[model samples]
Every structure is written in structure tokens, then in C-alpha cells.
Target: MSPTTDRTIDFTTGAPVAGSLDVAWVHGAAGEPNLQVHHYDEHTVILRQSKRVTYEAPFLFLLFGEERALLLDTGATEDAELFPLRATVDRLIDQWLERHPREGYGLVVAHTHGHGDHVAADAQFADRPQTAVVAREPEAVRDFFGFGDGWPTGAVTFDLGGRVLDILGSPGHHAAAITCYDPWTGILFTGDTVYPGRLYAFDFPAFRATLDRLVAFAETNPVTHVLGCHVEMKRRRRRDYPIGATYQPAEHRLELTSADLAAVRDAAHAVAGRKGIHRYDNFVIFNEPGKADQLRLLARGRLHQALAKLTRRN
Candidate 1:
């Protein structure tokens, strides 16, 4: 099927609406980074954390389900100087629970990887006996907080009453990167594997393999909305950033199609043939004197271009 843009619902009215949410970017204490959250619908929220000075890269969170809230990826660390953000997120989660009381509705916190930006707030949930952490690898679970078991690589499903989340392992961005799909909402929470800005791969080969898996998953799954761990505020071409970003807040709606996947595969092949450093967006990634890294970057770029095209076309 061809890629197309779909209408997103407004969180406040719970009605399908157009246009982006108005976000407020507020700086934390002592010139700490700013954070923003956008609520696309009652069930979906996207939280973004902008790096202090650069504002170049920002962390994102995709929260889903009402009573049994499932957090896709947590924002970057607010440790030391900027600890208030952590409290803010905690309070937000608490408010969500209070607003939609779910008795014995345990919180499920999952991460894209072990990166500090994504998993730093993990300790916050340590004391919450009702909260559980899910990871794709045991080592990641252990590395982050020394708890929980790894999720299987194949398709896995979690039922949240009226909402159902399907977990698919996509390892390209990180060895442990995973994507969550909500069938009812047609939302796909792609960790670092696929986002708005540049794609970073610790191991190019693994990243490409993971992308391939994702392509297959997309082909079989009915994904209408896509959320990434981060969105390039500049690339978004928005006038102002939002304030008080909430959990499971929605931002950019993804356009995934078979043609887009094919383009990504082509890019991966091209990267596999290059040598030395390859420039992508802002930073230059070292290709390890092999074609593997290049291949992965190419695949990432291709997927990105395809999505862009799909968005414009729609």
C-alpha cells in the first residue's frame, strides 16, 4: 500500500483533528535543558527534552494506554543540576494514574536502549513495586537497573484492556532497540531505530539487520501512526515548542510503506560499499574501514527520504 498521512486526534477533546499541538519549551533550573510534551490523543503522548546549549538533539518519550500506561522511551537524564525534570515526569505519571485510576494497574516502563538519555530515569521507578521494566536483552535490563528479563526477538503482544501493544525487536539503532505497535490506535513507537533526525548506529551491521526486521514487521502490521524517540525541532519547522510535555504525547505521524522500505534497503547497500567517514546530518560517523557502517547509514537515510516523500505526497 502507498504511504499516506492520517489525521491525529486532539488529546483534550478526544476528537480527530488537524494541525500540531502548541508546545511550551521551559528551561529547567540553572539553565538546564528544556522539556516539552505534546498530547495527540487521550491515549498517546510525546515528551521531548532539548539538550541545554546545542538544542541540537532532544530525547523523546511515547506513552500509551490509559489505566495501564506503557512508557515507550523515557527522556534524557535530569541528574545533578537538572533533577526537577525527573520529578516533573514522575508527577505527570502520577497525575495520569489519578485522572484515570486503574486499580492494580501496574506501570510498564520500557527503553530503546541503555543510553543515559533514554534510561536515566529508570531508577525513579525502582521503588514502584507495581512498575515493570521490559528490555530486548537481559544485559540491557541488568546494565540499566539489574532487573527484569529480555523480551523475545520475535513478535510479542501485551494486552491492556481496550489497547493492545505488539513488541517487535529492531536492533539497528542499538543492539537492544525495540519497536512497539498499538493495533487499536495504529501507532508504532520506534525507539532509536527510526526517528526524525540523524540515525546513529553503534554497530552498523546489527542496525541494518534490525531495520530489515522492522521493514518486514511494517509490511505485515497495520501501522498508521509512527512515533520516534526524538524529533528534530528545527526540522519540524514549527514556530514555537510546547511546554509541559506529557507522557505518551504524540508528535509526528509516520508514513511507512513498502516503497519506503525498499528505498531504505537500497541505502543500506550503498553504505556497505563506502569507506572511511560518511557524513550524515550534523555529525560524521566513522565507517570502521569497512562497508558495514556505510550500509547501515545508507539504509537509514533511504528510509528517512522515503518517509519524507510519503509525507509530502500525502
Candidate 2:
């Protein structure tokens, strides 16, 4: 089939349908002003936006439930100008809640990692009593800029009155990275562990393990929609590039399956092995000694490669 030049793309038909989800692109730099929103239902909405970018960062999502809302990964923050994006996101949340008001609404800000781009807005919402900074590790919460209160790891469920969100600890991209799963919508709010493009890895071995766990989870759970933290296009004119302008909701036709997770794991392992024993040892050191600065460059290289390969393959 010939590719359509029309801006809108539909995931359901895997074609460029004129009428689909209403997605507006807030244009800026290559990765700047990366914001996108998907209104799933009257009570459910998903908003993904970029805060800042040293490199192309993932788009963050806001998942609204009946009683409360959850933010899946906040974007980058390299400069001061980008800080306003947090307020923009907050406004969006407020608007969402205004449309569907509940008695006692709360906000749950979670992260895929401790990266600046993904967790920049933690401090912004720290004072809100209804808001809680949830993560897979207690350190992640304590270390967060805005909200420094600690939380627990493993699988924790947050009740949203009508629906329950299960936060699963799937460390690999970052030790504190976790994925939010909504059983009712079949949507998995995957931070960086699984996205449309490449997957980053701070620790290759642990990353692979996390991918394996995700695959296993998919086998038992009905996860039809894998909502990624970031999805940007390389070339706008390319047939595969879905994101036309920045902040636009790029409709991903790719259906994530267990096999996809396995492939990512394999790719990560392959890259880790190619880096040789010394590099592998470095990851172990970083993991054990907590000497992140020691392996900063190496980790960055590995993460870049892992993400690149994942993006290319996906």
C-alpha cells in the first residue's frame, strides 16, 4: 500500500485515516516541546510530552483514572526555559480533572529512571497532598528533586476507585525504572524499558532480565497497548516516520508482543557481549559499588547502542 502524506495516522487500521485520535503537535526544536495526548475515554486520557533534551528524550504520559491520575515519566531538563513545560503539563492535568472531577483526586508521579529529563517535574508537584511520588525503589523517591519521600519496590497497586493500576518493578533501563499496567485498558505505561524506538540500558544484564520479565508478564496479562515514554521520528518524509511535528501523537502501528520483548533482550545481550568482558565487569562494578561516575561514559555508550539497535529493529 502507498504511504499517505496526511498527518494523521490510525493505529487500528495501520493506515493513515482522516479521522482518528485527535493529536496536536506543540512544535519546538527536534525534541523540544515534545507533547502528545490521547483521550481514550471520558474518564481516561494519556498525555506524553517532552520536558527537555540533550538527546531525543521520551514523551511522558498522564494516565487519568476515575478517582486519581498517574504521570508516567516526566521529560528532560537541560535548561531553564524547558521548565515551563512542567507547568504546561500540570495545566493539562488540571484541565483533565476539571472535565472529570472526583471527590478527592490525587496525582501519582512515577518515573522510568532517575534521569533529569524523566524526573524533572517531581519537585513541582511535591506539595500537593493528593500527590505521591511512587517508584520501584525507595531511593528513587528520596532522591527525586521535588518530592523526596521514599516509597517501596516490587509490585504495588494504587486504587483509582473504579480501576486499579499495578506498578511493576522492571529495572534495567534504570534500577528505579518501573512500568505501570492498567488491566482494564490493556495499556502498559512503559517508561523506557519498552518504547517504539531503541531501549536504553544502564546495566545490560539487568536490562535483559527486565525485558524477560516483561515478556513473561505479557504472557499472563492481557497487555494490548504498550504506551511508551518516547516515540519520535528520524525523517518526517519517511514512510515509517509517524511523528510529523514535535509534540504530535505518533500513532504506532507496531503491536508489542512477548516476541518483541525477547528480541530486545537478545539485542541488549548481544551489544553487552560485543563490548567485551571489561565492559561487562564495569557494569557489575557500577551496580555493586554504586560508582556510577566510574562507568558513566561506558554506560552511556552501551545505552546509546542498545537504544539505537532497539529503535532500528522496531
Task: Estimate every model's Cα lDDT from 0 to 1.
Answer: 0.53, 0.55
| Residue 156 Cα positional deviation in candidate 2, in Å, after optimal superposition | 3.1
- How many clashes in each candidate? 21, 11
**TM-scores, in order shown?**
0.64, 0.63
User: Where does candidate 1 stray beyond 4 Å?
Assistant: 1-33, 53-57, 78-86, 134-153, 232-262, 275-314
Lowest lDDT 10-residue stretch of candidate 2 = 277-286
Best by lDDT: 2
Model 2 vs. true fold: TM: 0.63
Q: What is the per-residue lDDT of model 1 for residues 82-128, given as tens digits with 9 covering 90 to 100?
A: 53444655666666655565456667787766566676656666667
Question: Worst ten-residue run, lDDT, model 1?
Answer: 239-248
